[model samples]
Target chain A: MTETPAKPPARARIPLGQRETVAGYLFLLPNMIGFLIFTAFAVVASAAISLTSWDLLSDPEFVGFQNYIELLTDDPLFRTVLWNTFYFTFVSVPVSTALALGLALMFNTGLRAIPLFRAMYFLPVITATVVVALIWRWFFNPDFGILNYVLYELGVDSPPNWLATRTWAMPSVIILSVWKQVGYNMVIFLAGLQAIPTTLYEAASIDGAGRWQRFRNITLPLLTPTTFFVLVISIIGSLQVFDAVLVLTDGGPANATRTIVYHIWEEAFVFLEMGYAAAVAWILFIMVFLVTLLQWKLQKRWVHYEA
Target chain B: MTAHGMNRRRFVLTTAAAGGAAATVANDASASSGAVSSRFHAPAMIGQAQTTLTWAVPGNPDEIAVYESLAEEFMSANPDIAVTLDSEAADFEKFVTLVAAGTPPDIGFATLYNWPSFAERGIFLALDDYIAQDSYDLEDFYEQIITPYRYNGDTFGEGELYGLPKEIAIRAMYFNMDIFEAAGITEMPTPDDVWDWDRFIEMTQQTTIEEGGRTRQYGYVQDVRWTFWQIWAWSAGGDPVDNLYKPTMSTLDNPAVLEGYQVFTDFVTSLGTAPPAAVTADQGHSEMFAAGLAASYNNGRWMVPLFRESDFRWDVMPMPMKTQRAQTLSGSMFGICNGTDNPDEAWRFLSYVVGAEGQTRMTELGLLLPSRKSVAESDLFLNSAPPTNNRIFLDELEFAKPLPLTPIYPELEKVINDQTDLVLIGEKTAAEAVAEMHTQFNALLQGA
Candidate 1:
């Protein structure tokens, strides 16, 4: 042992860059493993389970594409829910996007306490969907609600029974969703508005352009890329709407507010039809995918990258 | 019966009902005597070989505290078996996750909402063997209350026993005397007071008041819950389904059911009496009633503790009757898990919780209508009333029907509501809604 001690150990060399990369990966190893298991693996498992009949309590029985077929052809609720999801997307995306843009323009005037105003506008986006829904639910109450009281004062004989009728239920849920979502979109639009070159506005004003004309000619064109991005994301987000409908109407007043995701939850948790829920989830994924793809395809015609 | 049991903690010593299932409870009869029955309660095992039981029940903090105190009392009596509370056990998703992971609590909970279906899925252990071995006195519980827990593969109440009912939620019409007097009605409901549907409607109309296109006072405020709606269908002499358990057809199209559905739907859409469904979306019917906005409210005993703080004088009354009287029964129960490694020990805990001692403790809080007849009829409940007619809860149990429970109940609930919502919105007649319900219900039933 004493003779062997004379021979010192040889040091293995590793490049600093490679060592850093290895250390970085090691730091991420735990989270990466977690993500792979919980997100990636679960997603794949869900896709496979979509082909089986599982009740969560029993062993899954493989049924090939039967779940998909049932949902597409035989399940009437599926069609109504899918149509409801699209209706929500088409209506909510534009309304929230336009409202967000309007807020961005109003707040971009270098007003005092602009951050405070922006924060106030974005408050609902960060608030719990359930808490806001409960408060809005009070506002929409047909009996003793402020909304009805105002309608009565305005001499409208009858205010629509919000969240209680086939026609008004979805709109009530839509209004709440728009209220919740507009804040987030407004922040993004505010960023887009600030990024526009101030010189363009100055030059246009010097050319005797009025405020409206300046916005129409210079600001609108320059903001098209941002608008396109907002549209794509808002459309995708709108298609996946769940929490508002859940807390507000619970896909009810005759499934009027029932969206694709609420239906998936009902199938999986409430009905214990996990396989059917997975199939519904997959269908929702496809719809969101196709709609986003279409939006991306259409963006090239209107999206402007120039300042 | 033992004379010494009279001095035991179970103060109610009413003679047990005469029935085939009547039994001689050992420890209960000799509770104060120097003896122990359960293995863990044996004198030799005092502070020795121990087993801990996890009891999962869904409850708010206050309710869980009630359970926890009882659990503490149980553990002190049986030092060898420590009982722990898992309040999260009440959530269905969490319950499923626990079961899936093979870590289900020794004791589990189920409601009429999912009890039968969960039993069918084998999530719980059968209790007949345990009951027979222990000779447990189930005759103390109402037959109808216990019937719902007896599942025979295809139907409940026909085969093997599966649970010990904790309590039943049987709702009755609670009338506010102040509103009734203001409406110029001097009649208060007697215990035997059973109003016909027409009489009930007349009273409701009289109670309703409107000012400036707004309802100043609602005649009656009933929850739009499908379970409540089903009472209208049943009390109108409509079966709603050929079979109560796992019904394969919808009798919602029956003329009587359609009649019940129309009258109830019209209460909101056309009558201008009850507020629109949106009122409930924003505020519960009970809250509205409690706030003195409604003359009468329909609810369960659980509301008593909350409603006691109300300013108005209110009393529970018998529900309106049509061709027959009907009320809805929804209940929760506890049973041993099938995966439990210690079934005997689990049974010891379950039998104790559902025993007379435990139910009496829970009911003392004015939050339960115990399945045990003695507890329900005792001074603890029947006499602890501003209702003055608290017996209505007890009497109405005679006419109560269990909420329709099928393996596909959640779907059936949606199927019924989807169509009924149309009726409530004036978009469809009861007949049309029933037609739609028939198609959807049959499909779900056959699929299940």
Candidate 2:
């Protein structure tokens, strides 16, 4: 009893509770400062710069809301840029999620080679986007590429020049994007799959449920949260696609594969229009914000939760 | 010690290495003065009040070594001044940021196309005062090449000189001797005979050998990255822009310009004699030529070092003719940053490197279409064999035109290429693409 009462006073010497709080904040100080300086400061600075007319060399001249107005009403290329971004997001996000879900479902079985197959699928997710894009460029080559060779062997006459033609260039980029992205989503989906109780599946199987029925009734209803998560992030990621566009086609074949982020980089670095680039960046930020908000709001309709 | 040594250190080396990089030789009894061989590893420090000038060295290890040697030599001459070589300043954005931050290198170099745009923003110090004071023969350099680097408050040429040309690159055609002979092309493209666009196309078509669907050997392949295709329009008396320095209109809509654009675009699209972007998609067109997959490749002297390593036999010739004759005149250049503290010291060093001796030493890099008239014409430049037609490079300078670079050059290039790419891919005709060019170019050129 004396020792038990003495424990409170003994702990008072070190002050673990208060010390932990201070130490936790102390440990986080470096990262917090970095985030505030590099990211938060940049974000606010760009928002201010969006209202100015500054080339890199000159002092920023305030232009109010004129840049946003110009982007919306004047710049013809902005329309193309937005359209291309939407096309990429809408196509790449859905295709990647669906393919990843399918991969998760197939590999969920307790097969001996599951780990091997998982690693093989996840290999591209870890490879550098630049290396992947460069290799994809070779594969996209119409004449000497393995892609065209395979197509030829399949008796498909006159395969399209994947990166050189306007119609096929965006699709080629989307294909590359989906391929690089699918593995990451699949791993996430696998985690979601593992969390689902096998007992529920077994009960459903005993109830004379078919493979399709159980997948629909129990698995799908439970997986809605994961699906929603995957959809939101994939959509956000697709809108900001830059490295692949830069390395693979360079927004070429007559600006066919030019995306919003790619245009922002070009305007800021290549054209030296810092203010204009910030305006475009703000536009992109708003777009991502609104899309994510819509998905978050709409999740109530399809997203299921358990008690 | 020699009593005259102290006085000789102050004697500036404003002259170009009229002979070689080591023009100072050992004539000076002072060992710290241009004794490159013995003092190259470390320039012997002699005098005090040492002013360190930072110079941006933007090249490979071999290039850095040469530039470092140049610095060592300069330091030996002016022992009072030390030079620091910074490779990071080589980046355009970083350099501009450093300038804006008010801590730019004393001397900086960038592609010639960037100088006018950079100068317009007052990024570089105007060297007119220095040139006048030194009675430095600006005439020692090619007038046409140097003229493009001049910038006033508004336009280029007829203004204060902004910088000096570092080296030059003039375009010529490279034909694989093996493929040409195999295709029965005995007569090389003669600068005198001056084959027309139609004749060039016919010759390429004859050499093109296709098997079933695959092109076994491409007749010709040109990289679409550069503005080298302007050779077609230029030879036909068609100007892509009204003036090279301050272009207000995109004259691609002109009859002759369209004729040039159409003929060049037709080679890949309608003609199919030259490799399309699809054929050369995996490899650069230059690499494709060096590999003997193409009969001829059109480029400047920059490709010489790469082509030299190839096992195949190849030679050079001037490009085909239209109504007029012309080729490209574009290269990199060096300038003193506006923020430089030691302008006098920087100029002495800059002038020497771009001068005859410096250019002769640079030719060791194997691609100095030397900026100095003396160096370009000297036996030092002419002796590099295998090209055989080196004389044509100098002769073409009469018609060499720099690209119409302006404050909006990077944007202008993207605008022009975006539309031209459409034409080349057969998505649109020359007239259609030019219509787009006119719309975009007016916005860019006049916007400035």
Candidate 3:
């Protein structure tokens, strides 16, 4: 009667979707916690630090907008670095993206050895930046560099000191960066090109469209989304260019190649002006954010979406 | 609540309780073992718990090995004070970050130029108390080497000792003997020879060779570093700053300083005694000298190890004087971190490294001049060199002045260097660059 025929215990009923949601959140907890702790918190902390005068070794003092004022109004080096960053971003992004698109188009042909050629082109992209920078430094050397040697053989008696002269230093850095980065962007472009429906190209060709016309009408418009993505990411990356400048010229030969990131690093770590560095970093962030927003607004003009 | 919900809650509570019990048991087990061990050796371990000290050093692989062995010897001597060597490969920025992070190594090797900044910021612990308490023989170290580590009364090289001397880096003229002989120079300047700036320039011009509308051989290679320029300015009886310890303004406008600055630039732009700034920018001065393309290069004693591998016969001579003979003294030093919990242990390690033993090891390595007078004077340094005139470094110490040791020295150096580059590359005149430098330097000083 234990025996009264005890009914089986009622199980708590949970909706399938609710359980799935709980499980999903549980699964995401680790990564969410890590991102919050490391990235988000660090960013917020740095923002707060921007309003203070923290030398890292000593106690932080609230300096309000002094760092910002000094950076904007008084610091000539900051201006130079900002200009250099802008110059690098404006020059490198467009040139590299165009070059990448061109390379992608060339390699997109169904050749049997296409993989090998792609790998060969991508080798510099995979190589360490420092190693690449060092190699290029030697190549750009006016006396013993291979670049100058080739220039000399080609009847140019005096090749400019590529990394030394202010006029050439930024361009030299741009060239090296483009060469190293074009392969990466090319891979992205290749993926974008592959995703384009072959029907459109075929239709264009059926209409007696030439290669250039088909590319201009079909390929470029369809690839705009990828191009926009590449542009935004490239601009952000180029603005933060530090490693090549550091390894190649050390912002040297009179601070010609010194970019914003390099200046921030020097201010933060070298000069121990953490607050100033934080201020510079925030300024960079604001610039990047505004630029991205502008790009979003401008994307309506160029970026096309396939229905 | 549903029966299943109650069961689930009970199950969770039971699991948590079990986990807590298991954790307690594990913790107790460890605690029991720890207690037993402590009780067994409590008499011996009363007040001598092990202290692990971290030492950060910046050096190449070879130098790191030397430092490791020094640390090893130190640990062996002091068993209670364990040491961990952190090699940074000469990244000063990383070292500063460590200090800023407040987890700085107990002892850190830093550049003498950075000493004043660290001292002023209270990053480096003042060693005067430790020295007085230990009765440490401060006299053993060369005054010039230790001078950079001193900061008192708002002046460097005059007050409390913040760091012990690690090396004596005195710049001297390293000339290629073969190049001089090939140029038909019979008389070579010795350390004892009082060669003036004019005589040095004459010798440089005599050795310079031009062929096929190109300078095949450069007479001298001047380093582009601010320190080398400082030596030139000092030799000309001009200085970048009026005060050695507390620099306030640029003295580059001084007549002698301007003359020295002009002469240095003329070596590249006008005289062609040395390669233009463009060529040197492509190639290092030491590299050019080692390649025998340059007859002479003025650099520190650290060049010995690099030049020893060269095929050419090279020797050191005193820097040519203008108004007076002057050389810039610079080197790395080890200081205890103020935030270190183990100051005594740190000082013990520091003293061991900067003491006679460490100096001897450095001397044997031939990578640096010994900071200790006895070690520098010993045959170990004098005999262990490719440049036979090793004594020139020691002799020059009498006239070697420490670099301006303001907290803003790096900024000041940047201003001077940038303006000087313009002059060297023929973009600006000496007066114009110096005037610009003065303006910039005063602004920086005021800000500091």
Candidate 4:
């Protein structure tokens, strides 16, 4: 055995760099495989599809930028949809973010049954969007809706039809989005709030700073990072809003509630214009990327970091 | 970042898992059943195996029973071929979507009104070749039933034909005798005795009365544009859909149609003879007539079933026509799937559905008036009566006109419905609404 060991077979040794590379690749295997199979492939396929006319059957025919051009200029509903989506994103994002931050601050303060309150507030975030949209639809119904009934009790001469009136539809949709979104963002901001040291508030108190002054000086500045994150995420989420709109309004009552995503859906599924829908999808992606980039650029002014 | 990242990761993981689970389910189901697994699956072999064909139909429970019985007979006659009947009451949209998704049954029921749309989308198999080769008895079908299925000027009737009429329904006035009696009305309105706007209003008023300070009854409700258009257009002495595929609402400026619309709208909005806007589609006129809440409702021969179970006596007369004998024709068509793996079997099933024996069986079930002219008029159909007035279908069939055949009819329908609703709701004046409709309709037509 010793003689055999002494004459042991030549040990094969891999180069350190090569070994390290192999290990790194192995570690990244799952994610790389996933990206290749899912994201990258999907993007390429969708882009290719964007140039082709497909009606879910038969072979697709390449139509170049015909779909894009139609969506931009010739499509009658595009401008209306873009404007509605933009309006929804702008109004709902800021209002929802503010409400979320306010709620986070309240919950961050040591309160009894804080976890229970947090869970209750986060309920809507966990509930299905369809169920939420349905509940909101019923609440907004003109004749017998609880909202209108409450308005009636308040002696308002004529409460506006929450989901019906063209003027009220976008606002109602925005209200619903804000309600559904506030919970998730609130939790995120609460985490950020808890992470901030209590010493800052104490230091402000030691300096005889009022509650409003402390909040304006310390809380707002310190919470800026979380606020920026929430703002970006919420705005991006709001822009692509589709499910609720599909279930509730169907972009109806004179196409008042038609969002860009809804238009894309109609083009793809209803009108069987897959190429046009793909183009719309790409356009939406670009718009979201640009908006997020703009937010990132803007964030430098207000976002604060410990480092 | 940690909490949010964790939540995001969990969500992604769960979504992936759910998708995997769904795929697993699909795989398992298909693995067990060859037809489901392969989607475009070929028929399975069991040595010297027999083949089974499937028919997809949209109908009420009674029609499903008729289909099942027909399938039994078909399979019994053709011992080598088995037949499966699948029935769903889901609308044509669902059926079309399912077919487009590539899971179409061997044979299915579709409406002639929607035949062009289906044909354009490639949901249907053209049976011209089969018809020419087989020398099928194409003359047995009613001329009206065959017209809608013909594209490119070729008849493909009954043998995996793109579509053949399963039933025929013609527009008529379905009057509730109970409501008429309550209104103290002795004579019912007939096609020949057309009511002027004033007389129509007076009749609606006399028929519509408030009992105990709540409006318990309605005299009439304005029908939707499709049904109402025929009456108004024929009254105005114009066709509903012109040869140019334009809505004859432009022709509504004609005194007769204008008067017809005025009378109709007044009966609903002005005379309080119709239900509110909320239930107008499903529960307005026809449902009111069924519930003994309306003296008269304008519908079609198709809706006699509402009175089948009703305690009150009911009857259908020819819809009051203004100029010519007018009735809007609407009916379902039986067609084979274009992408069916087994066209031979599908054609066999189609032949049975559109053939004399199949039509007689369908008639006997009282689900519909058969498309075969002979079957429709046969002692078989005339004698098999649930309401005891099966002859009304034949009477109305003579005046029936198939709705306009256009691929863009759905979009046109939306536009027309919107305009009609606006005019009815008094949101827009009839002239303004019709003008708007013309503009919108022309735009849609051009786009299509």
Candidate 5:
């Protein structure tokens, strides 16, 4: 005897788009929760703390904008640190970006061993900043440092005390930062270069364009978006330079290399002025925001986007 | 298809909610771990409750081993209490972060300079009650070393005992005997021989050696930092501040202070007796001295262990006197955290560390001068090692003054250090540097 056919299971009635949305949110939930708790919450809390005078141990006292007022009107060190940070960023970012682009162009020759050479150049980016700073500190030593020794051997009677002299301390730091950072930007430039079609260069060559002419007209114009990205990121990174300065100079030889972040750190941790440090942090945020905004606005003038 | 999609969406939404809830549970568990009681119940097998105390200390590997052995001995004696050592270099910022997080170590080590700030902020538990209850003999410690842990009204060293001294440090001159002999100096200055400023300079210049347009050896290398500079200024009958505590004004503009600063700066910028700022900037005073590149190095007892390993002969002598023989007193001390859940257990460990046993162990290590009177005076410390004149550290204790201990000491230090660097580099004269330092320091004090 034939048994009654088993009824087929009924399917769910939800829409595909809704299901996908739920799945997407589930995947993002973990990271979103972390970001909200650690980053977003911390930012808001720091802003609140900035309005109050809190030593780490004592209960915070509400003091409105007193910290900001004092820092702006009375603190001579504040002005000095602010100027030093600006000088570091302005000098390091452009110089490093140019050096990175030049290196990237030289490396993109499609040679048999180009990958090896590129990896060699990218080694510093993978090294720890503390280690790099320490090594550079020794190299910059005026007495037995290899840098000074080499200069002495080259018939130069004396070399500047790179990290100790006021006139040369910031420049020494800038040189170190460039050496440590150029590799990362170079990789980015290489990636950007690879994304550009070789057909454009071929056509230019057929049109009798020389190497310099093609690079100036086609390569540079097309690389504007990448250049803008590099410029913005480099400037932001330079503004927060602390590890190198902390290890190399300790903001010494008369605060020659004391950047804003270092000042904030000393105020917050060393001096135990958490509230003032928070205020300085906010000032830094505003300064970075303005600079980035200016960069975005100015990008339209030169950053060409390919259709 | 529509029904299937709807069911899938519902399932996804449920899963997502469950995941979020699970994450919340996991976060709560992690957060609670910090506050968890470290006591482990063992069904009262030993018929006593077990309590754990965490001690945060900073030292090198050898020192840490010594501490570990001490903990073992402490645990064996006090079986009811378990001790855990948290080894870290003394870092105030990290300590503050731990306190802010509400999980401060039960017992922690703080430098003498930082003890006041910690006490003023109420981070440390005043040990008066504990000391009174235990009848701990505070007089057993050298008054100079223990004075730093006392916090009085608006100043350090008079109010209440918040910490106990772990070790006492006093700065003196460490001379390279070989270098001095090579420079035709047959007789080295002893602790009793009080060299004046002029005599000191002449000896320093004589010890310096130059060859092939480069200095092979420097006569003296002053640290030029605030702590050492204060010693010079004090010996010259001046001080950075009128009072070490509750300082309302800077005494940097005192003529004697200027004279002291001028003498030190001239070593680098004028007399060329010492290595340039550039040279010391890299090699450091200790390294240069140890490497035989300098005839004399100015540092505290902490350099004993480092110098003991050197190939050259060296010894300690009193710092030259400009007006009076003065030395700088600095040290580390152990304090119980105010937020500690186990204050009694912590005090037991803290007392043991700064007690006779602890000081004796440290004396054996020779890294620091013991704070205990018995240990400091006994052959344990006095006859220690290479520095046959270890007595100089104790002999000068009476003259050793604490670095300024105001809450604003760090800020005051930065101002003086920065201005001093300018003087050392020849960018600013002693007069100009001290003038600026005075104005800035006064402002800091007023603001504080």
Candidate 6:
């Protein structure tokens, strides 16, 4: 026993200060509760309902994957909605993000009245979605509309019926959505741009780097975190785009603008097929989740953070 | 009888009127006492305390004034119950969202068509108890007006009374006098004067005017979903909904309906007498007519003020018939919500709405035909300005058919609009569109 005691027992250590841990946990509580309420439990409940069949009035009857099987194999409307949503997401996100970043860069310069220009650019972000949709609808109007009128003056023949024509309807909505949302993302990008230390750019410039080289090495790399954030958020948002479509198109011109979320709404509330709609909602959530996860996984290669 | 006995009988009748099918709420006399009874006559008893109850309505500024006046009258009668009328005014769509959201106002003005959706959601209360207890008269409400409230022949809510029909719009046509004169059509289109398919087109063509090489004014304008086409569909003997909850599009694909569609499209496009694609182009033909751009417009009686305010002189007539004379019955109803904490208060408000006093007051506003058949026959609505021929709407009440009552109307409407728009824009033929519509509508129905 004396010989074993010679090998000195190691003392168990306790952290003296809990300020960092407490602050971290305190900050985390809000998100944890929010996720539990809005996302986690919702997912579970919705998934359970998805496996069953129910309208709002009747109690749910468990159908055991019948809805999913039908959604995957049989439902023609589902395919159309999936296509529309994918088309919208694929087209809108990049165009809007690039435009926002460009605008942010333009406003972030050391120019006079930058704040005024920023405010003007952010006007659409602050305006109500319904108002934006209405104004855009009028602008895109065929006969008395300012859009077609301008095109007529420019000597272009046969301007498309923006809301009424199938070919142009989604494009029209996409344009409206980008215009409405770009201002919000631009503000975020501007904040990210401002946070980039000037020293890096100066160092790059001194090392025989041209303007393009300096930007390539410094600005883009430094802005990756912000870009990643915007990408994730924008993707999530575009998947759920409803108000503009509801106001402007009502999923018209042969259901071209009928996104997945719109289909869910139409199915659940309008058609009163609650169980099938719950299935649709769960499917949408999974799709959005996977897409976000994929982006997160990809971010390891592209996104760089200092700390 | 003693004054107390008379009041007791009055309370019994009111309860009967409020309770729909299975209630004898006259026995709930004790419940009506206490807080409910006090709130019911709070204004008369308390002499003014100023409590505001929310009211929802539709239409623009002037129409809002009518509600404001109604609110003022209700407040004046009940000084304790202050009222605030919150108007949606823009379109029926927002009202749907609000009601569906489950936080519907204390008092709301909504079309009866929307009541089924609300009732199915268990959001509305059965007013039968209130009616029976209050001794309100049920017979005053026209049978046709209260039809929508009945689900499986049971009134909306737990009892008979859910909503009272405040305003109704049986389909009517507005004819331009100048166009009629120019067309050499001396006889006005009337309920008695049923025009066949060819004559209707001929009359429309005769009235069409061309100026500056462009079609300035069309002979007629009608939308695919609203007033005129609905009448056409009815006249061709097609019911969109059967007795069962099935959509009857493909089942009733008579050639006459297609022929009617052809006639409508040819008039607008091939004949060049009407604005091309006008049916799919505008929200309603009344707007076109109001702008002095169309000869005749088929719409509801609500368009009277639009006509009156317009520079053109217009008069309304019964919608022209093809096979059997018919007009689509369109109207609104009032219902009490089951979740309402103040059913007695709501019953009191509804009593005034359905009573002769309220119906007469609404009639005087000249915005709608009152749901009471007696009110329609009265000089009150008929003698009003805008020259509403109240008799034509009332006379056609027998021929008035309600649209398909299904919870799936919004879906059905979308499919119909999409298909019809395709046809109007020359993307599909009438037969093709009808077939497509039948398929999609059935899929929705079966899916439901």
lDDT tens digits, residue span B154-212, model 2: 77877888788876778788888888888887877654666677777787888898976
List the candidates ranked by TM-score, beginning with the highest: 5, 3, 1, 2, 6, 4
Question: For candidate 2, lDDT tens digit of each residue in A221-276?
Answer: 99998999999999999999998887677787788889999989888877888899
Question: Candidate 6 — which residues are off by over 4 angstroms?
Answer: A1-44, A197-218, B1-139, B147-163, B175-220, B226-228, B241-250, B265-295, B305-312, B337-349, B387-392, B407-411, B439-448
Docking class of 2: acceptable
What is the C-alpha local distance difference test score of each model?
A: 0.78, 0.78, 0.79, 0.66, 0.80, 0.67
Q: For model 3, how does the per-residue alpha-carbon lDDT over B1-448 read when each residue is reduced to its tens digit?
A: 0001111112222222333432343344334434333433433365777777777765444565676677666665676766666654124665677876777888876677776777787878889898999999989888877777878858887878888877877788999999999988877777698688888898889999886556778899987667777777778788877787888766767888777777887888789898765566444567789888899998877778778889988899898888888878777778898889999889988888888887787677677888888888888888886778888998988988876788777777777768766776667887898788878888787777
If scored against the real structure, what TM-score would every candidate get?
A: 0.89, 0.88, 0.89, 0.72, 0.90, 0.77
List the TM-score for candidate 4's chain B. Answer: 0.79
Q: Output the chain A TM-score of model 3.
A: 0.95
* Candidate 3 CAPRI assessment class: acceptable
On lDDT, the candidate that comes out on top is 5
Name model 3 segments beyond 4 Å from true. Answer: A1-15, B1-48, B209-216
User: How many angstroms is residue B55 displaced in model 3 relative to the true structure, after the best TM-score fit?
Assistant: 0.9
- Best candidate according to TM-score: 5
Give the clashing residue pairs of candidate 1, or none: none
Better of 2 and 3 by lDDT: 3
Query: Model 6's CAPRI class?
Result: incorrect
Chain B alone, TM-score, model 2:
0.87
Candidate 3, what DockQ? Answer: 0.30
Q: Give candidates' CA RMSD values in order.
A: 9.1, 8.9, 11.8, 8.8, 10.3, 11.1
lDDT of residue A272 for candidate 4:
64
Q: Write the per-residue lDDT of candidate 1 for residues A32-120, one digit (tens) a residue.
A: 99999999998998899999998888888999999999998988788899889888888998999999999999999876899899999
Residues B1-448, candidate 6: write the lDDT tens digits: 0001111112223223334211333223223222233444456554554455555544433444555556566666767675444444112334444554555666655454455566665656666666677777767667776766665433232235567777676766777877787668877665466677678778777877765344566788775563356567667776554442324334435556565556665665478665544222323345678877778777666667657888766777766777788777767665664445566666666666456766676566566678786787778877775554556767777888666655666677767777776765567887887777667777776775
Question: Model 3: per-residue lDDT, tens digit, A14-67?
Answer: 666887898899999999999999999999999899999987778899999999
